[model samples]
Target: MNKAILIGRLTRDIDLKYTQGGMAIGRFTLAINRKMTREKKQEAERNNQPTADFIGCIAFGKTAETLSNYVGKGNQIGIEGHIQTGSYENKEGQRVYTTDVIVDGFTFIDSKNKNGGDSEVQDESYDGFYPTDNDDIPF
Candidate 1:
């Protein structure tokens, strides 16, 4: 029941690392733009308020490896995950609360470039029926 769906751009390149057991872990930040009216946006802009929320995210195993290999800063992606919360004692002897989205799955929302360009994905291996002409239709 605790699920989170987010669509945003990466704030930086994913930091990929491995555990002592050799399991891969990746950490990244996502920048999600806030939804607002024109007037509200203008007001916030004038006040220098942030228009985007930066969220911390983490991935594991194959997901982590895929993210590190294919995605980078400025690339948009859609992620499905759950929110995790914890607290730890830092070097300063202060309790630091942390929240992160543990990614379960993700999809690319951007094409080949960060500037937004149109591209086509040609999957030649598809086996689905594609009628090249009207004569190929059975119905």
Candidate 2:
């Protein structure tokens, strides 16, 4: 199982682009914090900070457009995906390997609204994955 689940803040606004065949793609990085607790009081006092890990992710197709329109820097989100690794030659002819998550599912965990209501924004044509009132039970 190559699956990964992450909940983090976006480092910046998504960079959106289209492929030659007009498939939309959005790329972004997520900053996740790791909190450490020290056993010793003196040591804990000296190291009371949270470390962050930045992860690269990519969303394609209608998902990409939805992400681009709805998300921005510092927005909190939950992602479910799989890891992908690839290598490419740089301008200096040095090969670089990159590992990134290919997003398969995403959920808005934090509302952009200041009043704590759902974000009024909606993408009606988001690859048909969004739920409709008639589709299921309300919980």
Candidate 3:
């Protein structure tokens, strides 16, 4: 049914733009970390490490503007979307294929107060641990 889900941190702030018809569009990259683990059959096979994969996503319409306004670099979010693919010719006449997710929905997953310094102060307004535009905290 062409559905995909991702939970990751934003690599940078969302880039907001408009189409020729004035529809808003936002683009961003997400960095998802995968924990690598090795199982040991003997006494020397236990190995664990962390790796990350970055992905591109796009959002359209009011959702796009909202995401751009509220989200920033390093914010963790959950995305639900579908995969889209396209191809284009470069200056050298080489064909380039691109793939990205067209986001349908998303949610904030990071704690209200990141960096672990002021959990209590941040939690005072942490409804679902997500900060709203109406919140008093400065972004």
Candidate 4:
């Protein structure tokens, strides 16, 4: 019952690291734009402001390595996970609250890019389906 779904763009490049036990861990930030009503959009336009929410996400194990390897800044992604919250004390004796979506699954929503940072996943070897045409897609 603690599920969270988020669709957003990567605010920055993904961070990939490993735990002492050799577990892969990836951390990234997503900038999700808030959907606004017409009134809200007009108000925001008048105010000249931005309407995006940046969220922190963490992935472990194979999921961690997969995300880090495939995407970088400006890539759009969709994630499904649960919210996790914790607090830690800072050097100034202040409590730092942290919230993150511990991702269980995700999808790459960006088109395949040939740039160096993001590698092109082989189509024949990929098990996931990538449609070659818009036909047969049931809307």
Candidate 5:
């Protein structure tokens, strides 16, 4: 019942770290754009305002590693998870509230190769065949 899904670009690179117990955690910000209706668009233009929401997200374990290694700022991705809310006391003695999407799944939205592929699309076929650009059959 607490599920949420989002598709957006990374506001910045993912921050990956590990705990003393070696648990991996990653944090990132996503910039999600709101659909602009004609009226809203006009209002935004008049106000010179942005029409996007920045969301905080967190992932764990291999997911964290994957995101940290392969994702970067401006990279578009699809995310699915639940919203988590918490509060912590800061040094100022004020209670700081926090909300984040605890990411459960992520999808790569760009087809452009993260790893710049060779001149030829080099890949291994499902049948255990390595295909090269020179090959008459595509990989």
Candidate 6:
């Protein structure tokens, strides 16, 4: 039950790449604001600290391709996924640990227009999970 749901803006464009075996992988950062009381807000302001957390995330296969093609920096989106953590030795002989959300589903949350006016742009979403039988998918 390691599910996580997040709604935030993309810190930068999706980094799409492929493995040697031709599997697609996309990496992106999400900036999520922190909920705070007035006192906490004032304290944060005084400390000159940001009130948002930047989270690293990744998507695979068709989901990665779709995201890389359609989304960019500052676009808001909702994603449902699971947290993954790992560690490795770096070239400097230091142990580096990492955490990321492995996205299973995502949906665009912002309109195409930056002016916030009404537009005809429809929402786009993608889900990565599929049934074991794969009977429902046409392709």
Best by TM-score: 1
Q: Candidate 4 residues 81-135, lDDT tens each? A: 9999999999999999999999999998884464633344555555567657567
Report the Cα lDDT for residue 80, model 4: 97
lDDT of 1: 0.90
lDDT of 1 by residue, 1-139 (tens): 9999999999989999999999999999999999999899899999999889999999999999999998888888999999999999999999999999999999988745544543334453554455487788798
Worst 10 residues of 5 by lDDT: 117-126
Model 4 residue 32 lDDT score:
94
TM-score for each candidate, following the candidate numbering: 0.82, 0.73, 0.72, 0.75, 0.77, 0.78
Worst 10 residues of 3 by lDDT: 40-49
Sequence-dependent TM-score of model 3: 0.72
| Model 1, position 3: C-alpha lDDT score | 99
The local distance difference test score of each candidate is 0.90, 0.86, 0.83, 0.87, 0.87, 0.88
What does each candidate score in C-alpha RMSD? Answer: 4.2, 8.2, 8.4, 7.0, 6.0, 9.7
Model 5 per-residue lDDT tens digits across residues 28-132 = 999998898989978997999988899999999999999888888778889999999999999999999999999999998843355754212445353446545
lDDT, candidate 2, 8-111, per-residue tens: 99999999999999999999999986665444544655687336789999999999999899888878999999999999999999999999999999998775
Query: Which is the winner by TM-score between candidate 5 and candidate 6?
Result: 6
Residue 22 miss distance in model 4 (angstroms): 0.6
lDDT order of candidates, best first? 1, 6, 4, 5, 2, 3
**Of the pair 1 and 4, which is ahead by lDDT?**
1
Point out where model 6 deviates above 4 Å: 112-139
Clashes of each: 0, 0, 0, 0, 0, 0
Off by over 4 Å in 2: 38-50, 113-139
Q: Between the candidate structures 3 and 5, which one is better when assessed by TM-score?
A: 5
